[model samples]
Target: MQFELQKALPVLERTPQVVESLLYGLPDEWIHNNEGGDTWTPFEIVAHLIHGEKTDWIPRAQVILGEGNKEFVPFDMKGHIKEGKGKTLSQLLDEFKILRKENLAQLQALGPTEEMLDLTGIHPSLGTVTLRHLLASWVVHDLTHIHQLSRVMAKQYSEAVGPWKQFMGVLGGKR
Candidate 1:
């Protein structure tokens, strides 16, 4: 479908709640374990989403809108690691909701026209891209992380599921 802010806003607005609902009050094992290696836990994913709210979405949109920065800064996906170190999961979830609300309000305030949405901006790695792609990406990024969050959480039961693990696509190694 064509990128439409009105259509996208509902998902964008509810993403934080979806995340919070899934993870708000689980035990440490459920909230903190990862798929291992350098992968993020649900806790860390919340932090990363908060980081994106503060640094990635509206900031880059401002660049596209010609508010200040002319080119997108390379996003620090790992910045959440440090930013979230001392915070609890509840704090991170609260912060994510607030920041996302603010950013969405700012976006609406921009009142971008089709011409503005069609305007191009320079991404550090992806070269030139349009505002429409950026907005669509903001919605999809929430979805991608939501999917990642679910998959990572489900994989925590990879071994416990035993014989049924093969049927669980989320746990991978599907036979």
Candidate 2:
């Protein structure tokens, strides 16, 4: 698929609202509940999303646009726990909305061209990647987390869902 910034902007811009719509005002127990094992709670997911907004997408884009082949700083996948310490879900949501808006504006300001999209950078683990790959990943990352949040919330009713569990793929299906 082509990398059209105009097309990507709306989805990127709407992610925070989509998360809020899915999660806001839900009971604390429900929002904080995890499916056990290594699963994340909805609260932790939001925190991680916020950390990505602050540290990942736009910063990597800047490196691709400016530094050419410079290797990216490896992202801290587990850093959100410290970053989100002492904050409530509502606070994290509000902060994410603000940060996402600012990042989207910065992306627009960069005005990436086709050549810019083709420019490459070195990822610590993924080897060479392009701006096009980064931008597309940003959009997909939002969607993946949205689906994760939905699945986590759905698991809250795993047992309560009764025989309908067979039809409700989210409850029993592998992620």
Candidate 3:
């Protein structure tokens, strides 16, 4: 589907709630174990989302809006490891909710126009991008992590499911 800012806000707004539903207060099995080495657990993904909320989406939009730097600084993909240290899953969830809420409010307050949506910013690596793309990505990025949370959790049951594994596509092959 074509990206529409109006079409996207609902997903963006609900992402925190959705993520919180999945991870808040879950057991270590669901919150800590990942699909494998270096893959983020559900808990870390919350921190990653919090990191993106602070550094990625709205910051990049503001840059394109001519409010700040013309180019986005490279994001630290693993920044969540340190950022999440000493924080509980519940705290990360709460932080994500607040950060996302404030960022959305700021985006609306920026009052983007049709022309503004087409205005561009330089990504540190991907090069030129539009406000529209950034907004759409923000939506999909939320969905991606939600999917990751489900997939990682499902995989926790991969061995136990046995013959039923074929019915569970989220538990994709190869562990």
Model 1 C-alpha lDDT per residue in residues 68-142, reported as the tens digit of each score? 557898999898897699999999999998998999999999998889889888999999999999999999999
Supply candidate 1's per-residue lDDT for 16: 91
The lowest-lDDT stretch of 10 consecutive residues in candidate 3 is 166-175
Q: Give lDDT tens digits, candidate 2, residues 1-175.
A: 7768889888998999999999998999878899899889999999999899888998999988884456788999997897689998899999999999999889989999898899888899999999999999999999999999988999988999787888887887433
lDDT of each: 0.90, 0.89, 0.88
Residue pairs in steric clash, candidate 3? none
TM-score for predicted model 3 compared with the true structure: 0.95
lDDT, candidate 3, 8-41, per-residue tens: 8899999999888777778887998999987988
**TM of each candidate vs. truth:** 0.94, 0.95, 0.95
**In model 2, which regions exceed 4 Å deviation?**
173-175
**Model 3 stretches astray by more than 4 angstroms:** 67-69, 173-175
